[model samples]
Target: MSTSRHLSAHIDRPVREVYEYAADPLNTPKWAAGLAGSIEQVDGQWVADSPMGRITITFAERNQYGVLDHDVTLPSGETVHNPMRVLPDGDGAEIVFTVRQRAGMTDDDFARDADAVQADLHTLKQLLER
Candidate 1:
């Protein structure tokens, strides 16, 4: 069965600030090192050169609700949906990333994925609050 793990970080920035920053695909290379070593916009899509090879990121339409969902298409042509959101929290905001465990993946792999997401979130928080 497929499963997903949700990880989050509290950033000391307003919801709009956090959402706008994260929603911009260009910022992926700054905080998501584990996913993309380098990312650039190409043909209206965010193309990433990652350790896993070249992949493309397609983000959802920008809106006022702080939704930052996107899809990652691997070199294998398999696409994975990433659900992320930024929510207002007092004077700051909470950023959440949902990590979906791929089919046939082992527990160790799932754990590593979660850890990676956590690390990415921490990195994003540090970058924003710096």
Candidate 2:
């Protein structure tokens, strides 16, 4: 059974700025609370490490509209479907984070992972706005 979690946040910046900030690999560690380091490429892919574990993000697409498709791998050796997007909201941007977990994982597991992602996003917002 696949499970999913969604999170949204509003940032006081333009969509482009938000997208740029999110797309930058070196900046990930600053925004991602659990990320200790990251390896990025121009092709839009990165491998990030944290105390819990390491995750890889492959950017499938990115545009000015603030939309991105990527995959995330958890420490439990589970690969998750992550489709993160951003939208323009007045002078700011609205970010949406979605997680799709693999079968056989408990809801509690998904919730815990989702909470971590949410916390990371909140840090991301703070980093960009500051």
Candidate 3:
């Protein structure tokens, strides 16, 4: 059994612009402060210093459909896949992030994860709309 929560934000920008910005791991530290402390490219792979220690960020291949799926490899050798996207919505764009509940996580912890995802999306909206 898998459980996930979807959080989204409407950004006043084109889908391409929003997707490009968000898909770039280098820019994660700006909006995803809670997730990424610093990001650097090591051997062509994006790595970041996070609360969980150094993690590798693997992104999907560049595409026209605004798919931004990625996997985060934790220091414990655990890899978590995150599904994300920037979709065209009227004149602007809608960014969506899927938060998956880890095994054995309490309900309160899952709620907090949702809240965190929402907060990060809000930050992304503000940063892009500026």
Candidate 4:
């Protein structure tokens, strides 16, 4: 029971197209600044450098239902599960990202995180539409 927000962006692309592109972790850094720099597979695990130091990123197995949920383990060993999905909306698609306010997060911190997620989703839409 925490404060949560579902930030979304509408993309002018098919659901399958959006899902395929986003389901790939390599494409993350191109749009999402949260992961920052680059993502590489180290010792069979996806690792990325972030403002919070190096972190481990794991994505849910690719599926037909457009479930793009992923788990991000911070350097301090805290794991945050991010729920994301691409759903059909008319001829295009809608990308939804759920951001939940975590423990110790102040109201300002939560708002900042939500803003970041929205910007990331907007980037995704721009990338796909072009």
Candidate 5:
């Protein structure tokens, strides 16, 4: 089993609003720094450029439960499952992302991934709040 970290950011917006905005993959690069600045739909799949080369991003079906899970297919054909959520936090919203440490990753690598997830969530918060 791998280690996991749950990173989140609180956004000054309603859960429905945040869910509507973040549910669209086209809006990803605007806040998701881990992905390239652009993404596109090709043959019904969201494709983007990544540090490891071209990749495919597949998100969970839209739902009322605020689940934003997704799977990222790497160039090597390995797919990583990412579970996320936009939860109600009083009048605001809390966006949560689960980061898991893959096999062969060191403690520093896992920490970096957690940091990146936190930063990405923060960006999402800033965008939605504005």
Candidate 6:
């Protein structure tokens, strides 16, 4: 099943700054609490380490907006899909985080994941505003 989490924040900075900050892999660890580090490749793929474990994110860019298609390998050896998008919203931007889990996961599991994504958005807002 597919589950999604969407969060919006208004930053005082221009859209370019916000979009650029979000696009840079090195800056991810600053705002995304779960992300410990990220390594980017010329092919637009990024390998990130988070608390849950490691994930490979493929990027597709269109102008200043982009989508991150993620495949996460959990400590339990289960792989999950967590695709996300960052789109320009007036002066700021909106972030949409989505996850598709295989069979056997409950709604509660998706809810927990959504909550974590929301928390990460809060952190992102804080970082950009500073």
Candidate 6 structure quality by residue, lDDT tens digits, 73-105: 565776666666666677766666665445776
Write out the backbone clash pairs for model 5: none
Per-model TM against the reference: 0.95, 0.79, 0.94, 0.97, 0.96, 0.69
Write down the lDDT of every candidate, Cα atoms only.
0.91, 0.74, 0.90, 0.92, 0.89, 0.64
Each candidate structure's count of clashing pairs: 0, 0, 0, 0, 0, 0
Q: How many backbone clashes does candidate 5 have?
A: 0
Give me the runs in candidate 5 sitting further than 4 Å from their true place: none
lDDT of 6: 0.64
Q: Write the per-residue lDDT of candidate 1 for residues 1-130, one digit (tens) a residue.
A: 5898989999999989999899887888899887898998888788999867999988989999999898999999999999999999889999999998898889899899889889999999999998
lDDT at 39 for candidate 4?
A: 90
- Per-residue alpha-carbon lDDT of candidate 5 for residues 12-120, written as tens digits (9 for 90 to 100): 9999999989999989988987755679999999999875689999999999999999999989898999999999999999999999998888999889878877888
Relative to the unseen true structure, what is the C-alpha lDDT of residue 115 in candidate 4, on a scale of 0 to 100?
Answer: 93
Ranking by TM-score: 4, 5, 1, 3, 2, 6
lDDT per residue for candidate 3 within 21-126, as digits (tens), equals 9988888999986578899999999999986799999989989999999899989898999999999999999999999998878989889878877888899999
Off by over 4 Å in 3: none
lDDT per residue (tens digit) for residues 43-118 in model 2: 5547777666766766655566666666666677666566788888999998998876657757787787778878
Error of 2 at 46 (Å): 2.8
TM-score-better candidate, 1 vs 6:
1
Name the 10 consecutive residues with the lowest summed lDDT in model 3. 26-35
